[model samples]
Target: MPTQPKVIFFDVNETLLDLQPVKESVANALNGRKELVPLWFTTLLQYSLVATVGDRYADFGDIGAATLRMVAEKNHITLSQEAAEAALKPIRSLPPHPEVPAALRRLQRAGFRLFTLTNGGSAALQDQIGHAGLEPYFENLLSVESIGKFKPHRDVYNWAADEVGASPKDCLLVAAHGWDVAGAAWAGMQTAFIARPGQALYPLAGPTTYTCEDLSSLADRLVD
Candidate 1:
């Protein structure tokens, strides 16, 4: 029999929340060049990793703005401060995936403690949760700010497990990113990979103990 988790820590972007609209917004802002969105996102992740390795940190919004400007410049596009700001405007208003609310509600009702661990800063995360009507579902919001690191950094996962007062073995890390799962698994937590479309698992060793197509399916597994 599978052991039930004492706490479940979720990844925000791409897991519970859909980032497609934000990508589209950035693409539109970049004058129909959709490729810029991925470029910016990759840069954002790269900088976050650099911060983690260098023992430095910047808020997600700042990183997003900086990366957008860099990407714009690289593409020979003139990016004003206003335009960079506009590119990130959709971050706060991203809609939750259709299955998120129901899955969260079901998990809450089933007596599982829920928390969020995201790369997003406190303000951005708060705005997103409020906008998505998901604030009521999570017991706590754990940001990378607290750990001065990003996902795939073992310390962040350790911090989350510690904050919830659960041993890593008793908690589950749920995310759409295989790197995140790999990190959490290495940190001793069980992992659930949400096979969200457009994301792929890394061909690496990790504790990807379970897989689900959506939050609802994951919730069903947990409750069962």
Candidate 2:
């Protein structure tokens, strides 16, 4: 049997929060080209990795605005810096997935220590958690900004383990991004992949310890 984790780390963004509002906002900024939102998001993530690889640390929000501008420029849409920032403003107040609150309650009741780890900056993370009323759910809101790297960087996971005083192997990372699952696994942690729409596991990575359509299902598996 798989060992039960003593600590559970959740990735923020699309893992716990629904990003549709932000997507809609970006779509509007793209001149109603809703189809471009996904591409813009992809570019945002891509540049985040670029920043990490180059040893340059920028807040996640700044990366988002810059990538939004890049996407707009590529598609021949003129986007001002202020407009790009405005489009990403919804990220601070995203609603949780319908199943998130109840699922978190179950996990907490089951005696698992929970924390949120994200690539967002400290202030942005605080605003997000507070605005979503999720502050009470986690013991801490950890950001990669502390270590000057992004997720999927081995150092970030190791640093997170140190922050919570837990051994990497004794913790489980639950995330909607396959790359995140892979990173945690590589960093010597267990992983649960939340198979959100349009998301899939990276075939090149090792198998995830658990795969569920949503957090409620994950709770069903974790809570007795």
The sequence of per-residue lDDT tens digits that candidate 1 reaches over residues 127-152 is 99999999999999889987778888
How does residue 67 of candidate 1 score in lDDT? 85
TM-score for candidate 2, residues paired by index: 0.98
Alpha-carbon lDDT, every model: 0.89, 0.93
Candidate 2 global lDDT: 0.93
C-alpha lDDT (0 to 100) for residue 59 of candidate 2: 93
**Which 10 successive residues of model 2 have the least lDDT summed?**
128-137
TM per candidate comes to 0.96, 0.98
CA lDDT of 185 in candidate 2? 96
